[model samples]
Target: MFFSPAQIYPFPGTSLAEDPEDIQKEVLENYAKDLPPIYLDVVQHADLSTLIWAPLMFRYPWNVVFGKLSKQNITVAGDAMHPMTPDLAQGGCSALEDAVILGRHIRTSFVQNGQVLVLKNLSEVLGKYVEEKRWHVTLLIMWSYISGWVQQGGSGRGMKFLRDAIFYKFLFLKMVKYVNYDCGKLDF
Candidate 1:
């Protein structure tokens, strides 16, 4: 899928009153015109009449104050707890980690409590799950945001230098190192 930034003007030519389809078409045409020949060729022949304009949404990790992710026995996982940019490609992977870690904690509690779901034990299990995942998810969110910013921060000289020189040459290794993280075996 082609991902392109679209500008939404608040005044003059385009307004909220304008038809959404017309705005999408105008934006696509305007942005697609600057594409390199190879990409332009594909866009020109492809059907864009049905193209959908959806806003890419992500919350900065700092926007959320670090606090308890569980209230009593109820808890959250995945995007519900931490929504991040797709640059790191860890959204789904981290969700799976949450599952494994949560399950591990729950399994331990279950086994210790003679396979019965005690409310107090479940609450402690959720707390352990949150404690285990909180910092990891926070780091993932921060790194993903930074990665996206550096990659798509435009063609300015400073940004290009940072993206190409600093990020690619130095920090890329650290960025991908999280992939080696073992969520551990879920077997009981």
Candidate 2:
């Protein structure tokens, strides 16, 4: 379900080792007060005893996440390359963009070579894909982090004021603009 203003639920790494049921119980208890009535109703009515959780993890744009974009014939994309908080709702969409762009690069290489793609050729092709996507992915990671921080309410009154004024008034549109990117054609 969607919440108008996003919510932040922090799970420290140490807590992740707990049993699923225990974790679920703890999460419900922790967010009980913050959950809206509609969500609480769904939880109760649907008997949400289990949670299919994937850690919503983030890494800086210049970290190992960026370092591993392309290495020889191997290239990272989607969640592997740029995992972000769910605030911007762009995680899956950006991954799809990566797949389409990667496929196009591979297909272009095959067409130009007019022969089977060998290891060296594949590395070159993958490198092209990485070059095409690296800056775009960096923007995504940075903006998505900002979007999450502002929407979920930051640590203090200053942040809260920005969230209420600047973010809502102007920043939301700018953030949405990122998601409207044109990936062009796969042409494969």
Which model scores highest in lDDT? 1
lDDT of 1 by residue, 50-165 (tens): 55455446564653347668989899898988788778889899889989999999998888888886887788899988888887888787777777767876778997998899
* TM-score of candidate 1 versus the correct structure, residues matched by position: 0.74
lDDT of 2 by residue, 1-188 (tens): 12223223442223352565665666667756589988866655544445555555656678533476677777788887777777778889989998898889888888778756666888888888888888887778778877776666545788778888788889788878877999889774
Q: How well does candidate 1 score on lDDT at residue 85?
A: 73
Q: What's the TM-score of each model vs. the native? A: 0.74, 0.73
Could you give me the TM-score of model 2 versus the true structure?
0.73
